[model samples]
Target: MQCMLRKQAQLWEGAVLTTVGASKLPKRPKVLVWIPEIGDEAIVRIRIRKQNPDLATGDWLLLSRKTDEMRQTLALSTDKKSLRFLE
Candidate 1:
């Protein structure tokens, strides 16, 4: 028998303003942040894996900036929630 392991992708560092439930999909949560390096305020949709109670508005985070095939939108890490609260 062969054993295989999948490695997790690295995420970019960033921060969020607030976390709000998506109106279309209540289960999905979205966040707002200002990426001065990229531009002004940008909205990032998040998929929580291991919920962190400390996660809140105006906190630093680790994000994944990978985009879809079209390369239009940036998405969070797929393996796990890379978001880390830095108070």
Candidate 2:
């Protein structure tokens, strides 16, 4: 049941028709995805090395429940892989 909850807790943002937010390529060569609605007062930011995410400003993404808890300058889930990208 715990596993099921994990799957169910995943939060997918945006759709093919609607985009959540666009990715930002920092000068430090990192991909940062920032979302504010689902997170606390501060925005939720996910970081990835380089442009591996290959995401743009209007790309949608899925964030794990764990990710939300560790928001505010966090780089997404670290306990387990919990992000899903739209194809």
Candidate 3:
């Protein structure tokens, strides 16, 4: 089966070739990103602030863990309460 994990966000990193969908919270959804890590692409989810137009399956977003949350809409949410992987 494909990997799925919920972890805290780090710096100097980002995700692409992504898909966004409903998360535990109706507002901030889980995102599927192909991240290059440890010589492999680890599928990671970094929760974010709600989007104007929420992303759907096959939708693409280039998010950065290092970017300022307010400045970068794709910046990962640091709120411990809102971080998780879901449908």
Output the number of the lDDT-best candidate.
2
Q: Which residues of candidate 3, in runs, are more than 4 Å off?
A: 1-42, 45-57, 67-87
TM-score to native of every candidate shown? 0.18, 0.17, 0.16
TM-score rank, highest first? Answer: 1, 2, 3
- Encode model 2's per-residue lDDT on 1-87: one tens digit a residue: 889656655745442233354454222222234444346322232333233444332232334333454343323322212223312
- Evaluate all candidate structures by whole-model CA lDDT and list the values in order: 0.33, 0.35, 0.32
> What is the lDDT, from 0 to 100, of the residue 44 in candidate 1?
32
Task: Tell me which of candidates 1 and 2 scores higher on lDDT.
Answer: 2
lDDT of 3 by residue, 1-87 (tens): 133422322322563334566564344444433333422111232222243223232233334543232222233322223332223
**lDDT: worst 10-residue window of model 2:** 78-87
Off by over 4 Å in 2: 1-42, 45-55, 67-87
Which tens-of-lDDT digit does each residue in 9-86 have in candidate 1?
123335333546777543323333333234212333222212444444233233545333433333322212323342
Check candidate 3 and list the clashing pairs.
none
Backbone collisions counted per model: 0, 1, 0
Work out candidate 1's RMSD over C-alphas: 15.5
